[model samples]
Target chain A: MNGVHDLGGMHGMGPIDPEANEPVFHNEWERRVFAVTIATFGGGNYHVDQFRHAIERMGAANYLSTSYYEHWLHMVETLMIETGAISRDELNAEQTKLAKEAS
Target chain B: MAVLTADMVAGLASTGASCRLDETVAPKFSVGDHVVVRNINPTGHTRLPRYVRGKRGIVDRDHGVFIFPDTNAHSEGEKPQHVYSVRFTPRELWGGDASERDSVYIDMWDDYIDPAS
Candidate 1:
């Protein structure tokens, strides 16, 4: 896999930091889980079956500007909230608390 | 406040089936076939990356076919699409100045392709 730094000049963008950083969480298992989610949903061409015919319907900007892991994170967060694995309030509360702690 | 019921927990767990690894299915396209990755952005949900839409790719490898849910965004409301391995050369995707040998491999659904030649 190409490191983020390898992307220099392709999109007219500069090289990103090449350092290998640790994951945000201390739990290796949690990091692994996040890696697994990113492994499948993180890259490439993907689609919804029933909505297959509507692919050409998406906006250009949304189609070419999002990151692979960002997409996966978005999907997972949506599922988590939708299925009650976590609630909107809980998510907000946790995020707020984390942000405050980091400050 | 009441405790969460087992049924409720199961309901959330049963949200839908997940993709399983498959080794026997043949892919629909081969390297060099011009194809487009589907562009799907639902207000509710989607797995397709925003950066790949409309951009063309060449079939890089046949990672074999697998069952991918219609729109994991739709709460299991649709069928799955046949997935394939496609590669995009960096120069082709990002234009000149991109590394000549750099290519990205991405799994795409069959519906995302059409004849390029």
Candidate 2:
């Protein structure tokens, strides 16, 4: 499982840029996403390694463009689908409903 | 230390066979044995990091039995095995002109390593 996530000891990624005045979280959404993902994962939907492996399964492009919490949210959805906690269609429909309600 | 109630640990630390060994398990190799990590590209979860794959190292010490992560991740069973602290020189891993003063030590299971021939 040598995915792009295992960037240890690799070269040419360039220096890490520590953001100035970065908050604990960028937004409320991220906070909720983190808490929900942790709670779901704690409920034994999947092993810790399994969750990490799922995150590593993402394509390089998707992994690169997404923020830290976005990777987590995607995994939450994936684990939900995989464990039969929820179906893809159901999650998608719920997403649509939420988007409409928010608008 | 103050005692903690059951509710405090609800659903926490409820899983995984413990990895500690109360009695010594026979080791395949002792300290200073030259070995090489097997090159394996597994489709499932593994504790063997990618950087050390197929690289030669010396057995620094035996860490004794531990739950094999490769199998535990898939619920395939703990399959606890002897894990060794193998120290790899930067030169062996990164080829020429790396760091002469630097080396990397990895805790590797029996299945992931073999005698360096």
Candidate 3:
């Protein structure tokens, strides 16, 4: 069996390409909106034209390094802070509570 | 911020839940097929770990599709990511020098694999 670290050189071993690697978002909300819109409005598979392009433009390294849910978490957390869905202080407290609970 | 509490977040979670399944329906592929996981990077969340990208593997079993968990993390809700058990030879990922007796197993979705010759 392969451990998670064993994946270091697997598919992403080639030289890093800056042109191919771009941040998919101008800001975090853009990312959240893209995901929300895809999940809520698009097909079983999210296929928004612009958003898809943005994601493709962001190379595989940053993309794959993130957890499946983490991308969404980053997006939504930004959106929450930006759109007032949740305040930064509130988010921090919640996180701390969750961490303490875990401990 | 203090106005919002755990109960409110929990309520939003239930209201936003989205895995959108058709349990009555069947999935398309099985384990062992060489498949390519679609390269996706959404704003809110994802489950596909970065370590396994573009690598090839064989299906080990048919893990039925379910709502993706990444959505839950983003608080956007859940959606299905067809999960499957995939086996990757250590050499394929690490290098030819990797132990011959060693191989790796991964629980990947259908989009993660492509035909391996």
Candidate 4:
């Protein structure tokens, strides 16, 4: 439970650099990812805290390095697999298919 | 049973049924009461942040009853109980160099605290 997400009273994370004129999202994919995550959670498979726990379950190294919405994307994928919503193979196949289609 | 319908999702998105104040089960600590957070290390999910555990604080405000997250996240039960905002002096938690003029107030459930002797 003691993951990077609980960075409350800790020190020495470096200064938080705020972006000037930052867009609502840095890119479009993040918006889609956010929508999917919200929709998945809305599906009633899990509660908000459960989603947070899944996010917290990420390895400390990966959790700390990834961007904010990247964490959301990873956790949503995790919940999808965990709840039998989608299997690992299916997710991989879909991603691969999407990548090919994108190219 | 399956995924929530669009209407249901819309309904679920707006409100929650977690906060419920039960009159029969009274709050043990009241506002201005001094209490110490029980240093518990539960294996599952908990709302009690890691930093605030085992720290002493004053009951600043009664937030009223709400679902206890410790149980709620684990599929145990709602376990609705009175929640109080505990104000901790920065010095009490973070030690020297912490500003004495400022404090951190964390919302704590009744189950998480005990009367400080």
Candidate 5:
């Protein structure tokens, strides 16, 4: 798939600036996302390539704006829903509940 | 579905899963062989990058048999085949203006390339 993720030769994206001692993850949610992705991957629900293709399927605009771990989260959510392991409604319900709890 | 327990986390994290297979698959091209990348644009998952399509390169090294991601991603099957480190000259990939001193070696599967005529 010719997706935005393949940014090898394209120009106009300014030179990358290396962060000074970048943290492994910027947020607590990122840590959980990584763990969940790994766990779900271990469960053998989908192949690693499938996970990658899911990320690629993200629209160009969304794919460019999101962070790396966010991409992983997207892949996890996409596959979980597509494989019937979880439904979009269940995910939405959980998100709504979490939002309420956070408030 | 297999549940991933806490005890398994450490090992799994340390030694990540590799797609490389233990099977002995014959390679289509050998080291120093000139080849051309197949101009394929599959809608499904493919490891072949867009830049390398239809480009000419030389086989640098044979990385042995590995699971083919193109089919594996679509529940098609592993379709294990030899993967090679193909050396593409900067000029060949990026045109004459590119530096001649540098080269890009990309891992290419047998299906992604064909013998150069």
Candidate 6:
């Protein structure tokens, strides 16, 4: 699929800048997202390619604005729902519960 | 269904999975053979980059048999085939303004390329 993730040779996006002393993950949520993605991946829900395609399927705006591990999170959620491991309602309910607890 | 246990996490994390196959497959193009990238725009998953599509290049090396991602992504099958590192001059890909001294090497599967006519 031709998506923004396939950015190659397109100009004006700005130079590639390396983050000084870049950490493996920038946030605690990112770390959790990574672990969950890897763990669910081990469940044989989808292969690497499918995992990548899920990320690529993200909306152009969302894909550009999100961080790397966020893309992983998106892939995990998308695949999990698609494979019937979880449903949209279940995920939404969990999110709502978490939000309520946090508040 | 296989469950990922606690003990398995360490081993699995350390040694990630590899798609390389042990199966012997005949290569379609040899080193130094000219080839052209296929202009395929499948709505499904594909490893072929947009920049290299329909571009001319030469097979630099054969990386051996591996699972083809295009099919593997969709649960179609693991169409194991030879993957080649094709070298394309910058000019060929990005036009004459690009430096002739630099070349781009892209790993291409058998389904992504064809013999240059």
Model 2 pairs whose backbones collide: none
Q: What lDDT does the true structure give each of the candidates?
A: 0.53, 0.81, 0.55, 0.83, 0.93, 0.92
Off by over 4 Å in 2: A20-22, B1-26
TM-score of chain B of each: 0.60, 0.81, 0.62, 0.85, 0.96, 0.95
Model 6 over residues B24-108: C-alpha lDDT tens digits?
A: 9999999999999999999888999999999999999999999999999999999999999999999999996997879999999
lDDT tens digits by residue: candidate 5, B15-90: 8899999998888899999999999989888989999999999999999999999999999999999999999988
Supply candidate 2's per-residue lDDT for B52: 89
What is the TM-score of each predicted model, taking all chains together? 0.46, 0.81, 0.43, 0.88, 0.97, 0.96
Q: Report the error of model 4 at residue B12, Å.
A: 5.3
Q: Who wins the lDDT comparison?
A: 5
Candidates in descending TM-score order: 5, 6, 4, 2, 1, 3
TM-score of 1: 0.46
- Candidate 4 DockQ, CA atoms: 0.51
RMSD of each candidate relative to the true structure: 9.8, 4.6, 13.5, 2.3, 1.1, 1.2
Give candidate 4's TM-score.
0.88
Model 6 alpha-carbon miss at residue B117, Å: 2.0
C-alpha DockQ of every model: 0.08, 0.36, 0.06, 0.51, 0.85, 0.80
Provide the lDDT at B116 for model 2. Answer: 97
Instruction: For model 5 chain B, give the 10-residue run with minimal summed lDDT.
Output: B92-101
Minimal lDDT window, size 10, model 1 chain A: A1-10
The 10 consecutive residues of candidate 3 chain B with the worst lDDT sum are B1-10
What shift in Å separates residue A89 of candidate 5 from its native position after superposition?
A: 0.7
Residue range A38-92, candidate 4, lDDT tens digits: 7777666777777778878888899888998999999888878888878999989
Interface RMSD of each: 14.0, 7.6, 13.7, 2.1, 0.9, 1.1
What TM-score would candidate 2 get against the native? Answer: 0.81
Q: Write the per-residue lDDT of candidate 3 for residues B1-117, one digit (tens) a residue.
A: 234344555564566534446564354566547765555644443446565666767777876766655454444554555677877777766665886567777776554555565
Candidate 4 lDDT score relative to the true structure: 0.83
For model 2, what is the error of residue A27's alpha carbon versus the real structure, in angstroms, after optimal superposition?
2.0
